[model samples]
Target: MKNIRNFCIIAHIDHGKSTLADRLLHFTGTISDRELQEQTLDDMDLERERGITIKSHAIQMDYTVNGEKYVLNLIDTPGHVDFSYEVSRSIAACEGALLIVDATQGIQAQTISNLYLALEQDLEIIPILNKMDLDSAMAEEVTDQIVELIGCNPEDVIPASGKTGMGVEEILQAVIDRIPAPKGDPEAPLQAMIFDSVFNSFRGIIAYFRIKHGTIRKGDEVKFVNTGKKYHADEIGTLKLTMTPKKVLSAGDVGYIISGIKQAKEVKVGDTITLVSRPCQDVVKGFEDVKPMVFAGIYPVDTDEFEELRGSLEKLQLNDASLVYEPESSMALGFGFRCGFLGMLHMEIVQERLEREFDMTVITTVPNVGYRAMTTKGELLVVNNPSDLPDPSTLASVEEPFIKAQIITKSDFVGQVMTLCINKRGVLTNQVYLTADRVELSFEIPLGEIVFDFYDKLKTISKGYASFDYHPIGYKESKLVKLDIMLNGDQVDALSALIHRDNAYELGKRICLKLRELIPRQQFEIAIQAGIGTKIIARETVRALRKDVTAKCYGGDISRKRKLLEKQKKGKKRMRQVGNVEVPQEAFLAVLQLD
Candidate 1:
């Protein structure tokens, strides 16, 4: 294993980490010409459609440098801030990282965050400036930034184009030279970090990790340090970039080991897999804990699709271990999972995956922040789901999460970005000019405000040239109250939330307007209201239904009558039966969207 090198590709979102992994696999001859496809690491339909890497993918390839064969274990990791915990786990499985900075865009918020993670791990870093083929490429300027920011040798920055496969071979050589070979004793006890795992229908459970010490073949008994569960290896294999199977894996190698563990709860990120008799003196840190900042309920548009929805959530949990979910039941919405997500992008990815993979339509409640509430009984409750909130009279105090955000944009657009943040209840912390055309601005904003498309708004204000990133800054006391909703003089249990005092009026009007658009006109007048406590701040009336039934159904066009009934049934599936007319999920989503 002297020639073995294990490394991971790290970059900001859209910096082409997956694409580069594809190129490396192709160059090493792991994937054949006939089997090759674009973005090979993005095996999921949702990932391909969204152009993001939501999971960490691993592949083993053999490359010959100067007529000497070497094994390169390449791990492709996610670039989003939400999946930073997963990124750390992927990094823990390797001894080196290929830090890719966009040649044109330079460094981004995620890049700096990930780089600090790598530094904390003391991993060997090989900095590469990608997108050299782009018209906006500024190789020299970005190289200087790398030298100043990351303390890398200016000459070591390899200029490469993952799209065109330019200077990619140099990147491989850099990996062999800069990244040190794994130095664990093969004679020692079997120990490995379970960085990632996937469920197999036939084999039960398969776990992927870097063998820190020792080795084992088929039918070997192993133990998990964290869970203390012992089991025999049902199967062992290495993953080819081609998604094919291979026979065995060894120490200093990156691959998955399949066993008789079927459930996801049995295998967890940061757990240790070791030999039953012999174990390592130390167990490596598996991965950082990833907390879901945004919480929302995922209910089926058709309640009968509950089974399918559960199956989709299970399938999603196969690769993405960071997604936290619990069975949540509501009086109005019935039963669903209260899913926790890293951010808006992560939430969208989960929703899209459920729709695409399970072929099921789902309705999600408005995303909410995790609130710490003190009840009248003096019980400190941390509420993630809005439906889990207590009555107003029982509430004592509430605290919401906050974040320190940094925005880099053109000097001219700085004012607009600041205004947008201020309107969102963000406190301007500081500002600095990064360059003549660029200014770096900071803000201390409630995490709830940025959780809903604030990044999109920032880009809109800055004309798509701004870069933004945020980190959690703990919780703060705020004048917050749950703004409940009432329809037709009946309070909707699901439609309530903890909102700040100043934004209640605007939020109330927005909700009313959105409900008007979402709930179709019906025979009975629909009363839409936004309320705080027993007081209603805003209201809108949905005029009674004028004409929904058609005369053709009575004429006995059987197929047409059946189709119309099916359409109405589907529409009713989304609506809550409050007195008369139906209220749909679109109404809930409309409240979150800004015009």
Candidate 2:
């Protein structure tokens, strides 16, 4: 077991972390060529569709070099900043990290951010330069950048093309040579950290953990260090990483332990697991609970599908604890869920999964940031839903979440990127040229401002050369106003906001155009208006919706026709119960899209 090693692949979005994991999985004979799906660890439908890993996935592999068998526990972590906590928790389970750098896009902002986290964790870092197969690949330059960034020998960098399996053998050898073997006493009291979990209604809670010391086995009574709840382990299984199961796992092994635990809350991602017989006094520091940054209300298109939607959420939560939802009743839209997510991308992935995986149609509200309201009545309110906001007259103070954004990009687009950040009310805090061709720009900007299309804008401004990584920098008191849209004379709660003074007009205009695009031709002329205070700043007329309802129904397709009407009625049910006009699902997302 001295040769055994565990490591995680870390990178930024589209930096090819999952692709690399897939290549390793194939190279180690973990998955056969015919059975392999691209980015196999991204098993979730949402992950595949979005081309991003929302959750951390782990698999074990057995590799032989010079006739010596070594077990490598490979974990693929989320690269998006929204899932930063999850990434940290995943990295905690490993002793080292395969820091993958895009050869063509060397040392991105997120790459540096993730590397910093790994360094703080004291994990041995093995740099791997990927994307050598690309036509514009800069393998040697990227290796040089990695050497400078990490202060490691340039030749130590393992240049691999995960796409074509080039240099994969070299990477495997480097992992065995450079990554440290797990260090802990197997004879001591059993101690482990529950880094992740998946709850199956049939198998109960499956907790994946890394044993820090001692041994845990089938039928051993275990206690949760934090909660003090005890359970008898029913079964112990190790991932062969070859897409199958092994009988048991011992110290330094990464695998799942099932104890017939039903609830997910029982064994959190960061909870400490220890033997009840000989408990250890030392408590391991677990990752903090993920606080959702972006929120949106998700409603089924058909009201009758409410139960189905809830069931889908329950199923998704089995694999993803980060996906949170609570019952939300809308005045226009019927029963829906106030879903919490790490960011906009997280929310979109869940929404897409619900539709594709469960075949359920859903209408989602515009994504918004959680607000901390200091009311005139001396009440501190943390509002996740716009519907929960107090009336304007009752408010005394309002503040929103902000982020410290770090951008690392080419020098040519410094001015363009700076202007974009400034337009979003970003205050430049620091600036430095990382290299002759690269500049690192730091700013304090509203988290909400950067959540929507900021990544795309950064890429646009930098001509696809810039990268950004931001983390929450706490809330700040700002000159803020809630812009409300009145459909007729009544406020449309869904179309409300907390906006900065200078941005209200532009935001309102954007919302109006979005409304025009979302609101199909209705039976009656609808007035779309965006207002700041009592003044309407932007207005657009949505002509009566045309071609919405089909006049004819074929006799052979009565079931389909009835299903369609039922869906329409269900949609109408979810729409707030205003006096007369019914708002469509598209109206909620209109202001969210730029094009």
Candidate 3:
């Protein structure tokens, strides 16, 4: 156990955590020069294309120093705020963390968030200033900032260049010396924590776990403490670049367990794994179920593909335990699934995966945060969809989720950023100066205010120098009303949204203008209107495509032309009365993108 070191890398997005992981893998001789790949731990194509780590990955490496062999377990984690839970889980499975700060970018929002999480887990932190080869690198200033933020000695900081592989060996040596080895009694009762799992078509559910005590071997009968389901361990393996079969994994070892459990719902992340024959007295603590923050309705473009979409979502959910979905039907969009996500990015990724991986085109409704509705009968209900909101007469009060947000930015754009936040219904809580030119701003804002384009606007106002992170605080009382869009006097439920009463006029007007530009002209005029309850706040009309009624009558009598025009006008009036405007898919998406 003394020769075993387990650690993870935590950093801000685009701060080179994956690159450093690749360098460690190469320096340790875990992979050959020809076998090495860029962002090797980022196994998803979406992650590689976006230049971010969306999932956490673990691998075992063997290294030697002065003829002394040591085993290193490295877990690479995502840096985005949406995946902070994943990062926390990874940190829990390790004894130490390498906090990587870019020499050029210094510290960002997620960097601070991850640091606090590591501190909460009581893990040893090794600060590393990366990207030293860049000409703009400010290693000294970043080092000072790290000292001020974390309050560690100056000599403890390590300078490394992930691109050039400089100081890689020193970092590895530091991991072995500074990160304590995992300690547990191998003779104790079998107990393990499943940090992650994946579904296998042939082998059933493959659970990735860390053995906290006792031993696990092939053919051992294991039971999940939460679900109370038992299955025999078909195989036990250590994860290198791939799974390498092993006969046994003792305490302090991290590996995968292939249990002959076919159903993905039976295996869950953060669940305890114990021997069925020698069951432990108490289940491991610190396991909490993940609840999604944003909700949206997803429907296939072709209604007949509902089953295919359902199957695709199920398969995707097996890998992503945070995703939740249930069947839903919409008046505008037919049969579909109302899905929940960790955030906007998670929602986009799931939609893209369904289209790119499953080859099914889907239409997604506007994303919304859950609302709390108190009925007249004193019943509290949680509403996820705008269409599901009860009538005003049936409700006593309505509450919306709010978040405590932190923004780190340069002082030059402080005023502009503050204005932007205030416009989003954010109330300033506090402010602190990290340096002469850097400031941290805190605000309590409604989650619905920033769910769509707040981040994009913040970047635009700060000129890409601002970083933001937020967490749900709780629900707050607000005068919110459901805004429904009506086309040709018919309500479109898919286009309904809940908004604060104060901003209804402006938001409704903007959505109406965008819809007018997106909807194509038809034979009869289409009246697009935005309304709150029975009152209309904004309206736009898509003019009909007119045809010359007397185009073929050359030198005809004036009376003939007049009669033709009158007849055409009457026909158009009748058509407008009974015609149903067919709204294009683009119009629905455009309304969601309204600024």
RMSD of each: 6.8, 8.1, 2.0
Give lDDT: candidate 3, residue 162. Answer: 93
lDDT of 1: 0.82
Q: After superposing candidate 2, which stretches have Cα over 4 Å from the reference?
A: 33-37, 133-135, 225-229, 242-248, 304-308, 509-579
lDDT score, candidate 1, position 174: 95
Candidate 1 per-residue lDDT, tens place, 299-410, comes to: 8877887877887787678677878888878766788889999888888878887787668788888888898888889999998866566788998888899999988787
Better of 1 and 2 by TM-score: 1
Overall lDDT per candidate, in order of appearance: 0.82, 0.82, 0.90
Candidate 2 local lDDT, 123-240, one digit each (tens):
9999998898899998777888899999999888888887898888988898999899999888888889888887676888788888888888778899999888999978877765
Q: Rank the candidate models, highest TM-score first.
A: 3, 1, 2
Worst window of 10 by summed lDDT in candidate 1: 572-581
Best by TM-score: 3
**187, model 2: CA deviation in Å?**
2.4
Q: Kindly provide the TM-score of model 3 when superposed on the true structure, using C-alpha atoms.
A: 0.95
Best by lDDT: 3
Q: Per-residue lDDT tens digits of candidate 3, residues 488-563?
A: 8899999999999998899889988998988889888889999988899999999999999799778969999999
Query: Candidate 1: misplaced stretches above 4 Å?
Result: 242-248, 304-308, 545-580
